[model samples]
Each structure stands twice: as structure tokens, then as C-alpha cells.
Target: MRAVFVRPGGGGVEVRDVDVPEIGEGEILVRMRVCGIDGTDLEKAFGRPITPPMLGHEVAGEVVESKTSEFRPGDRVFVHHHVFCGRCYYCLHGSYTMCPLFLKTTIEPCGLAEYFRVPRTNVERGAVLKLPDNVGWEEAAFIEPSACVLRAINRAGFRPGDSVSIVGVGPTGAIFIRLLKSFGASVVAAADLSSFRLEAARRLGADIVVNPLEADFPEECRGATDGRGVDIGVLATPTVKPLQTVLDTIRKGGVLLIFGAPEKGEKAEIDFSKLFLRETNIVTSYSTSEVETNLMLSLIASGRVSLRDLITHRFRLEEAEEAFQTARDAGRSLKVVVEA
Candidate 1:
């Protein structure tokens, strides 16, 4: 079998022949169908590298072998890469993503492979979700990212009809727009430097779209909310450049949700006194556990939301490098997927 691995020292992705992953008791082997290329995957490939170097996680596939009766060889599913131990302190506190076991557990050899093993721990914890017959591989590939957005909304205690502002209208940002509107947000203001993404946001139901380069993002957000500022401000880009800008777009007592994880050592300057005086709250969301993934799956299955249009580019596994390049071009592309 062949798998995509991030080239060491940040060059790009390389496909190499590797032995097929073997399944053991309570484990399952899945043949990859399609996997979404995430911003983190591009970071690992062309920027700084993170541990394990397993590139893809937004994946969907078919079970080729199963050792547990919970799933069969022919099951078509979306497998979550991380699962928490329900007994851990984090899980007990409802911080499932912070469970120590969550980060340590993952799909074997990564999701960007011809085949990968679902560990017993993940299987037992209900990490695999069967796809509805109506869902396609691309739609299934969106489960993880959508789950992540759902967690951020949950953490921020988002209220329906609250005015929202998104600082980065990338693929995930688009998801935020779709979900927020479905939940009855009164208005959504999307900001991005890229006109392409701004247009995409408008098409996805944003009431207002602003190119920060052309207009003041904070002003635009405030203008849309009748000068009260947005009730919720979301930072969806991985860079900290727009952190304070996003923060400035929130109303007093509003919530600023940092949904993007910046590279280590990246810093942003903000007015601590202003935040304190204004009663502004800051919330950070990490990866999702099965709790959010299941909800995301149900939403997709129930036709409450669709991610099909967010997929702007698709490539074969052999064209993984090209896919990475396209993903890097945020001005032109949204979600890029690699088909097996």
C-alpha cells in the first residue's frame, strides 16, 4: 500500500509504498476513499512540522477488515482520529478533547494512506460513524472539520439570533457561516483579505462580507450590527495577525472564540484593560471528541447542512503534491480533497 507522508524539514508531501496496516482484535482496517487536506496538513508539509507527520485526518473510507462485531468489512464510515478515555479527569470534567489519551490515540499510519488501522481504543470508544447512503465520500470527509466548528460553537455557548463575525472566511470559516445561519443567527459578517473567499462567504449565506484590505473589518462588523458590534467574533485563520482585529469586532460582553490554532511562539497584542472593562470573554476550542463528531454526522445526514460546495478542488492520491499547492493558494481554493 502507498501512504502520503510529510517530507521532513517542510518541503512537501511524498507518497511511499508501505505495508498494509494489519487489524487485530477490536481493531479495523479501512481502505481510504477520500480525505480533505487541512490547513494543518499544509503547515506540516510546507511550514513547520508537527509530531507523527500523519498528514490527513478529514477522511472517509470503507472498512476492509474488522475484528469487532460492531462493524463489518463492508461498512462505509467516517473514522475519528482521536478518542478520549471516559474515565479520565478531562472527560469527567466534560473536557473530552483534553483527555490525555485523546492526543495519544490516532488512526495508524494516518488518514492519507491507502489503508489504515483503527485501534481498539478508538473502536471501543465509538469513533467510527457509519455514513448514510445518501452521503458521498466528499461529504463524509467534512465530518471532522464540521465537528470541530460545532465544538467551538458549543464552547462559546452560541445563542441563536446572535450577530456573528468571522475573521477568516476559509473552508472552516464557511462552515461556521452555514451552521450559524441554520441555527438562526440574525446576521453574519465575514472578513477575509481574499476577495475569492469573501465572495464564497456571501454565497454561503453571510449577510455581510468584507475584504479587510478594502474596508475596516471591525467597522464593517459593527455597521452590520447597528453599531453594537457582533455578539460573537470568530478567528478562523491560523495566523495571529488578525487576532486583535477580530477581538475589536465584538460588542461589550460579547464572546471572541479563537477557533484557529496558531503555530507555536506566534503572538498577538490586545488591550487587556479593554477586555476587562468591556466584559469581553475569550474562548478557545481544540480538536473534537466523538461527542461533537456524532452531532456533525447527524446534521449532515439529516440535511440540516451541506459541505459539498466547500470542496473547491479534488485530486487523486498520486496528485497529493498538487493538492497541497492548491490548498496553499487561499485566494483561489477552499477545501482541497485527495481521492484514493
Candidate 2:
């Protein structure tokens, strides 16, 4: 088996031969077809701690072997890396991601490998989704990420005809724009440093595109919204350095949703006085659950949202290094996929 291994402390990525993992009872082995690469994979590769160490997780593949009768060899599927134990206290309380079982389950050897094992815990907990014949492999690869964005949209209290300002217009931001448009958001403003991303957002339905490097983002949002700012401001970038700018772009009673993920120990200096004076609320949505995954799969299978639009680059499994680097380069790519 061939897999891409990331060494800790920025050691670099290694594409080498390793033993193909043997699945235990009730487990399934997936022969990778394609996998999506995002910032989290980059973090794991360049030396941050991401558990199950081998690292890729937005996977779409075919079943090579399965211990369970429900699935068979040759079945195409999407492996949900995290699964929760329904009987647990966290599950009962609706904190599915917080369940200890959910935090620990993952595909063996990781999604970057040519083949990986799906644990029994994952399969039994609805982590394994069999793809319909109508769904293509590349589109199936998007189930995990789209599920994540769907969860965030649900938590955002988003409504039809509402106004919005997105702080970052990367691949995830594009997904937000597409879904927001479906909900009939009248004003969709996107802010970014990249003209390519901003343009992409526009094609997806952003009415106003602002480059903070060239003009004031808050002022742009206000101008777009008749000086009331936006109804909801989304901080889609990974750093909080833009926290104040995003906060200032929202109406006093609006919500500022932090959707981008930051590294460990990353801190933001926010003014308590300002926050107290304004009634703006801050919220965040973490990893998705089986519930959200079901919806995402249906949305794709039904052709309501096309993940294919986000696919800007594709590389062979052997070109793993270049693929990772391309995904890291914001000026060049949207969604980068590694195909086996």
C-alpha cells in the first residue's frame, strides 16, 4: 500500500510503501478513488497535531472488502471519519461531536492512503454512506466538507432575504455563498485579499466584492447595506486578527459567526466595552454529525448544489507533495483533489 505520511515539526511529507492495514470484524477496507485537501490537511502535514496521523479525511472511494453484510466489495462510498455512539450522554444531549467515541473514530492509515480501514464503530454509527450510481466520485468526495458548511448554516439562524457579509471567499466561503443564495439572501457581500476568490464569489452570487487591502471592508459592508452594516457577518478566515473588522461589518443586533478554524493557542484581542455596547452575537459551528452528513449527501445526489464547480485542480496520488503545496497556495487553486 502507498500512503502520504506527514512528519511532525514541519519535517515534510513522505510518499512511501507501507503495509495495507488488515480490518477486524465488522470493519471495511476502502480503495481510494479521490480525496479532498483543505487547510486542516496542510496543518497536519506541516507539523501540527492531527490525530490518526496519516491525515486526509474528505474521502470518496470503493469498497475492497467488508466484514458486514450491509456492504460488499465493489460498492462505492463516502467514509465519515468521525462517528458518535448514540447511547452516550453526549449523544443524548445532542452534543454528538463531543462524544468520546466520535472524537476517536477515524479511517485507518488515513484517507491519503491508497487503502484504509473503516472501524466497526464508524460503520455501525452511520459513518459509512453508500453512494448512489448517479453521484460521481469527485462529487462524493465533497460530502464531508459540504456537511460541515451545512451545519454552520443551520446554526447561523440564516433566513430568506437576510443580508450577509462573508470575510473570506475561499472554497468554504464559496459553499456558503451558494447555500445562502438558495435561501434567497438579498445582499451577499464578500471580502477577501484575492481577486480570484472575490470573483468566484461573485459568480456564485455575491452582490458586493471588496478587497480589504484596497478599501475599508466595514465601510464597504455599510455602503452595501444602507449604513446599517449587514444582518450577519461571517469570519471565514482562520485568524482573529480580522475579528474587529468583521464585527464592525455587522448590524448592532446581528450575529458575527466565526466559521474559520484557528490553530491551538491562537488568541484574539477583543474589546469587551465595544462588545457590551453592541448587541452583536458571536457563534461557531464545529465538525458535522451523521444528521448533517445525511442532508449533504442528499443535496449532492439531488443535484441541488454542485461540488464540481469548486474542483479547480486534480493531482495523482504520487504527486502528493505538489498537490498539498498547490492547495496551500490561495492565489492558484480552489479545491485540490488527490486521485488514486
Candidate 2 regions off by >4 Å? 47-52
In model 1, pairs of residues that clash are: none
Candidate 2 Cα deviation (angstroms), residue 20:
1.0
**What lDDT score is found at residue 11 in candidate 1?**
89
Of the candidates shown, which would achieve the greatest lDDT relative to the real structure?
A: 1
- Please provide, for model 1 over 1-340, each residue's C-alpha lDDT reduced to its tens digit, 9 standing for 90 to 100: 8888887566898888899988889999999999998878887888754334678999999999999998998899999998999998879999998889988999989899989999999999999999989888999999999999999998998888899899888888988998999989998999998888988998998998988878898998888888989999999997978988998899999999998768767778999999999899999988888888999898999998888889999998888889999998989999999997
- lDDT at position 171, candidate 1: 82
Worst 10 residues of 2 by lDDT: 46-55
> In candidate 1, residue 85 scores what lDDT?
92
Model 1 clashing-pair count: 0
